[model samples]
Target: MMATPAQPDNGNADVRAVERQQVDSPFFVQTLSRELSASPRRIAVAIVLAFTLVRLVWAYALGFGIDESYTIGQSRFLALSYFDHPPLHYWIAHAASVLFGTGWAIRIPTVLMFSATSWSIFCLTERLFGGVAAVFSVLFLNLSLFFLVSAGAWIVPDGPLMFFLACGAQVMVRIIFPSPGEKEPTIIWWILAGGLFGLAGLAKYSALFTLAGLVFFVIATRHRRQLLTAGPYVACFVGLIAIMPVLIWNVQHDWASLRFQTGRGSPQFAPSAFARMVLGQIVWLGPWIAIPLVQSALHAFRKGRTERELFCVALAVPAIGYTTLQALWSGAGFPHWPMPGWLFVFPLLGARLSGRIRPAIHYAITISLLTLTLLVTAVALGGSGALHRLNVPALHDPTEDLIDWSPVAKVLTPLRVGRPDGPAVAGLDWAEAGKLDFAVGEIAPVLVLGRDKRGFATRSDPRLAGRRGLVIVASEEAWAKKGSGLSCLPEDPLPVARVPVGRAGQAELTLLVIPVEGCIGAAQ
Candidate 1:
């Protein structure tokens, strides 16, 4: 016989069973101190608070942006190859989804990865500088605008990439100049690092840039002697091997991804693009601290013969130089592309400034840090309306460095889900196209045709015309390069849907959905 709901605990058949987890699992209550620091106890409480609150703000307030859906979609596929980027972030995010569950889980791996990196930075800085600089440095990293906004909530190659890159940086510095009383870095340690690089490379092939950075940066400095060591060479080669699956995948696909990325770099490497990229980096670095960081970077190289200083400077120089070259060579680079460069430089800056930047540098750093935090709070809380209302030109103007996919995804998702029979080729927006490729892959595979890229369309070419299911995922500016019909649209959206996305009630996205789902099997 079944017991009623009013039965006592031991005798009640209706009592719900509760399982034990961590001491502070969601089921348990946590203290204020427990929710604000690095421990699992603090993290569990704080993560739920931050992630849920931020996600709600973004979910309702943010319209789907160009790359959002597609990045999510790519993570869904979890491959080592893609039309753009290697497959590391995608697969990890996918794996995280499987581990924790998707939607929010897509972001969990990145969150943990970034946090660990920050913690490692804290430890490294603590060792290099004093505890004060270390704490502030990690604090600055976690609270910084780019950290919270672009790189934080936004799941991309750079987040996981940054984590591993930062880890490598920690290991790298130790290998170059062992700190006083520091243990000798062993071969097993190098192997562990080699594995991290392999995993990091899967995030973005540009990790090769880091590999190149290490070789050149070391040669440029006192660690130049260590270059003769077999460990160093083995470490480098092993990293390449670790990520070799992606290379193999690329070769099988005729290196289409590499050509697509490298070929695109030329226009961005032009004079103007390079200048914009530099300016963007300065902004992300925070203007007040940016100058000093630059000073520290320059000083470490120019004013130093010491092994410690040389080792620190060595890591910073090459990756930044390579990134600059790529931007000048192409008209665009991912905004977060400079991340590993930042990771390398930060501790270098700390090491240089340890006894120096403190107290004196504290004022500028504090002002800069506070200003950034205020700006972030305003932006995060939907208070950017004040800037817009005041007609701050910066509030309304769009810089071309980054693309928005929020509105476009909003337009595509419901319409496609509602209809379940439409997909098409896009004329403009690889970010949007890539995002769309990711978002729609699970529900149905959409064939995004090449309207740009000078004719890169093996994925959806004429070889499969008679097959069913297809769609066009183009933006107006992109279509202008080729489609006269799309180019000539006189306002009102050229036969499509447009959705806008933004915070503070402003529209920021534009997804144009045209029915063509019949070409899916064809593309497949």
Candidate 2:
């Protein structure tokens, strides 16, 4: 008020104004900064909503995939376990199917599971580092091609596995790195963590790697006292109890499930499998994520180790190592095996990006955002047939597996609609049977021939024992080579129709009307 020499024209305020101008100079950067500055909760919600919208669009646009068809068939009958995976996905699908209906309804649980996984990542990251890291973690995870577009969006076990793993990771973080002035949490956190780990096990056997990671962390950090505590034992008990259904099912069936799962891994190493694993990691996880994972491991080993350092290393190494071992041993295309491994690394990645590696993180975000836009565009165009004009080879056709089965349903409905009580529609294997069933929507009771005991094999219809049915056979090269011209009635069959079902409706499959001469061979 005393005329204060006109405030002395402080140069600091002028410099600050210049700095603000520089910060907001670029329109794109300004927009991103504004977004990042939003409340972490709001940012998380927006990310989840955006990711969910993309998934829902794809779900609505595309028809059921082969695996989805199989899932629906399995969900139709509640079981303690399944031939291919545990029962959680089927259970969720069963509930969704009962509540909403099939088709998109079966996928609703995946969407919700993925949302939960994303939110869990945000929470875990925020707790470990801060809000900015949480946002970055969510973005990196939700934008991954494998995580977002494939397993994360599909109605599969991986969806639930990732959700529970993320929940368990948060609890594990608290156990390993409690904040300052904090007492160790009651056994509740460990109990909850174990329960989540158990649920993850119920989702997929790969969850063993998660538990292994926990052990590795304890051993590496010399935190053997954790073993003496009730937390570890409780976790073990809870996880075992969670997967009790699988164990019970195996016991009743004479350990068939355990035998089958264990038999999958053989000790034959293939260099090509390792190469594929490496390449796939780059493509699906994106270089942004892949690099950070390697960096996190390196930092843990090369620098002073802390609970944080050791935790990140353990979470990623065991899962990735197990996946690599599988791939090298079996030479199977197990690209998504390392998904959970990549998951816990996200927070560490986010922390690194927000700290000294801010420049690299900025570039990664830009690339990932652009890549996501392109992916959405491609998926949309795929539905509209715009991408088909590119004449991509069938082998490389990403949408080949998603071929519209409505045409097949149309042709078979006429043949089966008149014979609902008899063996109506049949397939040479469970996959085709499930596909036909999903497409026809109960126009006929679809049956599978041969010993391919998948989901459809478990369903025995006494009516199908000797009844004649129309068999829909996929036009594989092998089938064509042995062609005696498709037939019906096993003794002297007749070809009812050979309908071509695909993008252009060209006959790629032959529907044979065959009578079940004997008990169609049992599922192998």
Candidate 3:
């Protein structure tokens, strides 16, 4: 045994030592910090491009979500505004649809918008803190799930809202905190800020919270004197003017959108709902990241000495506060609703995190990358129908939503139910209508049969009156629940086809195509 004990493997020992040095040593951190500082802009751009590439792949992998389907389907008409949100994102998606013919192409604008958002965050953070902080801020922004997937790649209003808000915040910061030599920010800067804020409003009504934050910042800080200047008033006026279209559209619709939005907030309080909402946010933002973000926000409010710290806190509080209240009161508040407000907290978080030890940063990055990889993998598997093989229960399978409804389109396209001056296709629910509308595309006039028709109610044509057509029942249970509504037809609905819809090779649900005569306008 003594003779068998030979010399140690120096090569392996050396490699282990090198690994430890790279992972554990401060020298590695210093080198990284120097590199990041040397070319922060390039690193930021690289982060944006890398995330953009991942998002592009993701966009192609998954089918459109319910909101995305609704937005794109309704965007075909190109209105002044939409039932759910303002017209900006819809217009952007519409333009992309026109150029690229819908499908995944509609998500292009949102994807690119997030790129701009990343750049804006980088610039804004660098201006407030420093280059290293700015780079980390962009990295953190892209790493967060809500920002990475929802705002980054999805066809949603959040993308444009985040972009415009970030840019506006940057402009507002310049106005509030001028350089040492500069006496005051120019009027042009104020005007630009207002215009940017207005565009943010056009993106989503929630942008008002950020605008309020700006006002609060002006009043609470030494910048209160700036509020007296015409610069502030002119900015407000410009912002109001920019969002006039939303007002005009609302006025034309008898303030229906306003009423709908205002009415969404519940009058009663719900502790469980509020808890769920907060937890949902933590999950969406990632627990590790969200915890630090909360700490950063608290730190900024408690001990922040600089104008930048107060600025982020001011802009962030209103949105996060209001949405949290809405969740407590309504119980129906969504997770992503508070995201734009949290967008401001990133710089503070970046600055905070950048000061931590290298191992901590590495740990956070590893966790974030792992989470993203898992999410992307799940999406990819679901989109490719591989997950269906697992036989996960339909209700519990989150990936079920990613199932392609294009199969339904293939079945219905030949029928031409939406043809003008002829029959129409009907869905029992608004969500179903959206999916149906997207799938059928220009081939048919898709309408909602039941109440809660959303935008489809306005888009429904009188010409469809008394016309016979096919109704797509998403499941047997849905038909069982709503099939009686079609009883008014002269004859019973004939089962035209049974389209098996699911992922992979398993059938999770079946699409029932039933032909009904003389019931085109009956259910609505």
Candidate 4:
């Protein structure tokens, strides 16, 4: 036994050593650090590319969302601004559609814009924090559900808004807090900041909150002297010039857009609404990421002493604070409203979490990917009618919202062509009109019979008044009520086609396309 003991169990020792190595430094962390160390920019670019690929797949997998359909439908007629948001994304969507044609291709512009946004965030974070933090910031930003799916891929204002806001913040950071030994920011930098901020305003109204943050930073910080210089004023003037289109449009329309926006905030206080809004934001940014972001934001606010900390706190506090408080009013605030302000906190979050050997980030990312995969798979299944076949309840299945009007289009195309009068299509409301309009494409004009027509009201054709067309009512009950009142419709007009507008097996709504003759005014 003593002689045999001399062998010394080398294989067991080797296995133990390898286990210790893994315990000390996870393979994931090691590979991540090694890749990051080689080139942070490359890692950032790779992240952007991978996310973009996912977005492309997602965009094609599901139909346009309600708001996306509305944007696409209304953007066919260009305007200075839109009722729901600024015109930049609408312009982008229109341009993308012109170049690539409609369908999922319209989302390409947004997907690409978010890629630029991620790069901007990376550059900003790197300049303020470090390369590792920058990479993590991009990772976290892309991992967030709202930022990833909605802002990243949807044909909404957030994509362009976030891109411009991030770019503006990066430029402003250079102007406000130049690195040690760096030259004073030139007028060009200020001008660039203003232009970018203005472009952000062109993307969404919430950009003003961020712009206010910038103004406050200058006033509250040691950089107030910059106010004495022409730079700040020039930036303001340039920003004003950039947003002139929105102002002009509002003026021309009797400030209808502004009034509408202001009207969204109800006077009644509701703590439940506030709680819901907060929870919505938490859900939007997954709990893992949101918890860190809140911690970073609070840390910046309470104990931050550095110039970068002051800057971030200044920019972040206003939007997040204001939106959260505004949510106390039952009608005010959306989950994404505070996102612009929260955007400035990501660098802080990156800095706070940088170089930490924690499994949370790894697990968060893994969970996010898994969640996204499950969501995408479910969406694909729903779109393909597989989920429908499983008897998934319409109420329980969220993918029902993703169902497009392609089936409706198939039924309406020949009917539209057969009518010599070339009747306009109509829907009960803006959402219905949007889906129908998108489906009909360039074949016929689309109109909303209801008063809440949104952008459609502004673009309504007078000629559609006297033309006979099909009216799409979602339910038999709805058609029974509204269809009977339209004098132009037959006394007992039969549905041209009963099309299901949701997942194949379980219809969310049944579209009753009743033929009518010149009843637009009465319906309205």
Candidate 5:
């Protein structure tokens, strides 16, 4: 007979199962504060909560910046896609407005996206390295000025793009390194990853860079054969399907979106342009974070411990290379265009710097402290009139593009109210059009009166073509010297109000009354 087998400890096993279940529950996250040193889960929750509170305060400290104003204008019109970017940012802001009614309330979605991004970073880093590395990654990311403000505080496409990109990246990591009992990354997970990538594309066209990164990883890894499998194809199909709304919109508009984006690509290379791109990256990422990100990427590529490590580095290349070459050919590019790639680098940095994170830990803390100091000080100084009291020269004017427009609105509102048919209001470009729309769009129809159409091109109403209107042009006196406002009107008009809007109060406002036959007749 076989030796008597020891009876299983059923009661102890049941107790352990209950503990595991409790730990895995989302409710357990907050309790980790009790064991903060040993639990990354609780640490992540605390960091995210703290970051959320800080961003909430920052959001209310100032009015919307120029880009925020533009996005707000777009939120008024719901479309499949807009002239500038995908519509998701506007859609989300629109939802926020419905719930909270504009003002700083619109920025709530951005704060939430930032939180999700932080959590995703934690999960991704944890999967690749360990819990400590995950915590470091969250701190590293939140400390970067670009990530802290532009990506977090502002209502821009990057926030949503980063959130989706992080989600997809985390999913990719899961697929690459399944848990102990899992045999393989299921087809369902691959489908889910593809869907996330698709949603990212819906957020911004730059998500193509992410797709390219994924493809590169698959090719470089031993999972190259997966392309022959249904998983890769399913992912591609899902992504394509997810972006269908954008495609449909473009199709309906004669592919205007595609043409517009394609035109932005550089036709040839220029070192100066490439240098500008590099400079932008350095400024955006901050020296401390940027240096380590690059070093980590290089190290991962040269001496990666496993296929997963190398694959992570591959995710960053397409965006970085594309932006760099685009800058070379175009002679200049936006600093934030390459940001999606940098998102991948953070997790890799956490993993690469596992044991060597001491130096960066201090740097992250210092930068966070200094940045908060400068932000609070700036707000305080402006509120105290110290900024205006400096009376700096025009070149050094801190308030050049940022002026309170209530005075101008005060003057224009009566004129608009006094008119019959609510005479249309106009501006020479999208910036003025958007600003005027925000200022007093409710008083009358607002139009962009120039060749650079933008969002207003589709909004131009034939009925308003012959209507009387006022055009407000806010710019430096130098712009006036160049006669920037004259090209939009058929006849000369007198100044209705010269209101101080920006630095030196050099902005101009003029009256233009179309003939009874209308502006359409005048233009012809």
Candidate 6:
């Protein structure tokens, strides 16, 4: 190529000027700007406020589904325990129902529990670390896919479990961190902490993770050497004994529920299961997960350990560790297996951009988070058409599906209508029987047990065996295939109704009806 320096006088100079203008264009400037441009505090406030609204509003609009129906039944009955989880949630719901009433009313306690836990997370992180860490942890805890969904949407024992977990953590903070120069924490707070944990144990077994964390901190910090000399363990013992109602329930039922949960079997570990679980946590935790999450972890080894980071990191360890183990083994698990991760929010966030945010930055950040929440909510509620802006699944509506008991129950109800027949109902599938129980009430006869512990536990009690005038319920196909002999049915079965099955959304549930025989042959 020939050098053109001699032509720079006019044409070359004009070309150079045009190149300068191109470099200064708006697109180039915008491309160089920060992806997120808000003050951290504004970001934090916006996230919490938006999450609170979405959860409460969406939850109220929805109807009770399968699990809620069972739990409400348990609460009204106030048993020592249920086949799933524990009895604490039922006991709490029972109280809520007394005041709030059944159906949507009992959910008030769940709503309150969520609010308290959230505030605890906010305060704990802000005090332990710094504004950046606080915001980061809060965003991670609140916005996590599992967490956001569980907090307001689900009516499980987890709501109370999380509440007590947060309450216990807050009290520990006061006791461990102590005001500036205080020598020892007040005895009453320690007692209260013990009591809260005692109740937590009744709510869910996972709460034991918190107690384990406390024991770990005491040993890790070498404070356990003074444990016997410091305070009374009597109050703790009393609180523990207070939850004996659950223990008694277990004892009476041959510990079936607990044994069932503990004895869960899985085939083998899958390499991809652990990987996918981690990926799920990452999306749920959001961007903040990368910062204080990593920084706080490393900060633990520094000369002057980041105290706040330590607390949050230590708190989250149990949940993460347990979930990892559960993923490796074969058994039942849930996305909320990592629930305790939320406890870390306060400390980690307190230590992480916590200063001098601008006004425009606030609105910009709020809008960004709002967009994320909206998209997530859309996917969760089973309508992501508009948000196809992202490549996420569009079908995950947890509640509000009709579940198709109408068809099976449809043909049978009329045949026995106004007649003084027995309350027998039959099912070849668990869903059909459960759905019927939902519609006609659990007292309906012939609620045949499902093959799984979750189903069998409800109806396989000796009390429900071979009752006269019982109705048998199963899917139309299953009923036809095994029409001659159902374990719960008599030798001679009578045809009652042939109900057509239908699909509701993505879920398929159908039922068939037959007369409940007085008795089946031995061991059926």
Best by TM-score: 3
Model 1: ten consecutive residues of lowest lDDT: 15-24
lDDT of 4: 0.79
| Better candidate by TM-score, 5 or 6 | 5
Candidate 3, 264: how far from true, in Å?
Answer: 1.5
The most accurate candidate by lDDT is 3
State the lDDT of candidate 2 residue by residue for 222-290, as single tens digits.
677788888889888988899999988878767766676777646777879889988888878877567
| Model 5 C-alpha lDDT per residue in residues 1-524, reported as the tens digit of each score | 89998987767886897677566544533243235437778877888888888888878776665577767776777888877777788788778878887678788889989999999989998888788778878877887778887788788899989999999989988887777887788799889988998888888999998788788878877878877888878988998998898888888888877777777755776888788889889988888679988988888778526776766677888898888778877775888999888888888787765564444444555777877896788566433434565666563544333344445556665665335655665555676567666666545566665556576666557457455644444443423543334444445544555665532334322322222224322111
Task: Write the residue-wise lDDT of candidate 4 on 321-422 in tens digits.
Answer: 888888786557788888888788888888887756245356546766776886677567757656445664553555555767767767776675335576
Which model is ahead, 4 or 6, in terms of TM-score? Answer: 4
Instruction: Report RMSD for candidate 1.
Output: 15.6
- TM-score for all predictions? 0.71, 0.84, 0.90, 0.89, 0.84, 0.74
lDDT of each: 0.57, 0.71, 0.80, 0.79, 0.72, 0.59
lDDT of 5 at 313: 70
Model 2, global lDDT: 0.71
Task: Tell me the tens digit of each residue's lDDT in model 3 across 1-524.
Answer: 36766877767886897677676656656576567768888878888999899889888878876788888888888888877888899899889998888878778889999999999999889888888788888888888889989999988899999999999988876776666787667789989988999999999999999888888888877889886789988888999998998999899888877777778856778888899889999989989779889988888877536788888888999999999878787877887889998999999988887675365457656876787777778686677666556666653666656655667766665666545654677787788778777888577777777767888866776346455544554556577777677545555566677888776566777788876654654343
Q: Which stretches of candidate 6 lie over 4 Å from their true place?
A: 1-50, 98-102, 130-136, 181-183, 230-232, 266-269, 280-304, 329-332, 353-421, 426-433, 442-446, 453-465, 474-509, 518-524
User: What lDDT score goes with residue 85 in model 4?
Assistant: 76
Lowest lDDT 10-residue stretch of candidate 2: 477-486
